[model samples]
Target: MKVIRARSAGFCWGVERAIEIAREYATQGKRPVFTDGPLIHNSQMMERLEAEGIREVGDYLSQTSLEFGLTDAEKQRAVMVVRAHGISPERRGYLKQLGMKFRDATCPDVGSIAGRIKLHARKGYTTVIFGDPKHPEVIGLMGYTEGRGHVISTEKDIDFLPPLEDKICMVSQSTMFTFDFERLAQYLRQRYPGALVFNTICGATRERQSDVLVLAKQGAEAIVVIGGRHSANTVKLAALVEKQKLPCYHVETAAELDLEQLGQYKVIGVTAGASTPGFLIDEACEKLAST
Candidate 1:
């Protein structure tokens, strides 16, 4: 069996930046470093950071509680790092009100989407987000809409949108599937002729998905996608592989790889989500090579 790994697999620029910032703070040993949430979706990465003395605090929308067993004084004194996904403006304001010292590690691409929503909303345009509504990125985006935004995951959801007298501005989560976003954009164009659509899916996501497509076309009998189960981008890659009618397995780490099943394939493609760490991808590749 041969193992072919996607060149674009593993951490993207944003995730890399976030991790770098967290590590810098952790290394400085300053003020009990804490992230607003998991720095990234990968559990292994999170555990590694925890072992290094960096910890995750509060949810995106809520305040930091005694969840980390930190006393009020500790919570107040600790430096908070906002996760890559970003947080709602309301939450930012609330944090400010509490006088918490925090650093914003929001990805530039995601931050741009929020800025676009705010810009359009100020001009009386309703923002339409194409992605999972419950996602932290989308939630932060909705905060910029000034209550004039709607979240829809599909073209069908577009039908349920409230009637809009003004123009509509449509944007998508940075990690969403590009094809899905385009399909929905096409539908919105036909339904609302004046709707403005922005392809907010980041270039890294496009590259990762494109790499998987190339692997499928290259006749890989099976594909292994590595990433956290909760990672939206990683799940999409696995789904894309399955859509190509090839056997695909989504695993969080090498331990989850089904060696017995994968041994049957002559050629196996390996790819990972944007949030995946390089070491995890290396482990999967090593395991496959050994088998």
Candidate 2:
């Protein structure tokens, strides 16, 4: 089978920078490096970081109390890195109170979204975030909205919103589909003509989404999306493939590929989430080419 790999099938700049920050601390050895959550959504990469002495200390969402049996000396030598997905202000404060050095590895793109929300909220605008409310980035952005923030994922979500007398400002989670965000933004404007909509999806995300179409144009019969199951961006890539009317096989690793089923395709297109590492993408492409 012929294999075509996407131009943007690996870690975005933010994830790479976050890993670099943690690894730098891990290598120093003077302090134990820890993250509030999985630094990125890739489980395999997290395992590798674990081997490098970067430990995860908090829950996946960065919620709940963290329990560690550390002495004062240990706490003094510990460093806590915020995940690339970022954390709410409350979570940030809680993590800081743990008595470790706090470093924020939030993607600058996410920070910009938070800044926009914070600015609008201070000006008496009710912020509406188009994202999964449970997503750490969205949860974090919500913290900047003062007390007037609403999370919406669909038109119905917008419909169910209460009548807003305050001015409205809208933004999106960094990983969402561009078209979906635009569609909803239009709907939001129809409902609230004065609403301000900002498309905050990162450039890397747009590149990855565009490459899926590039693969189709290259005559791929099926598309393979490689990333962790819990990776929101990776899941969206697979869904986008299906939206393009192509067969999409979403797998975390090459081992999960159904060779028998995949063999039916003469040419396969491969893409991965922003959180996916290059090694995994290479392995998947190699395995498919071998078949």
The TM-score that candidate 2 achieves is 0.97
Off by over 4 Å in 1: 61-77
- Candidate 1 lDDT over 1-291, as tens digits, reads 799999999999999999888777677566677787788999999998888777886676456562566677876777677788988899787555555567888999999998999999999999999988878899888999989989999778999888886589999999888888999999998999999999999999999999998898787899999999999999999999998998899999999999999999989999999999999999999999999
| lDDT of model number 2 | 0.91
Q: Which candidate number maximizes lDDT?
A: 2
**Model 2: clashing residue pairs?**
none
Error of 1 at 173 (Å): 0.6
What are the C-alpha RMSDs, in order, of all predicted structures?
Answer: 1.9, 1.3
> Where does the lowest 10-residue lDDT sum fall in candidate 2?
58-67
Q: Write down the worst ten-residue block by lDDT for model 1.
A: 61-70
lDDT of 2 at 288: 96
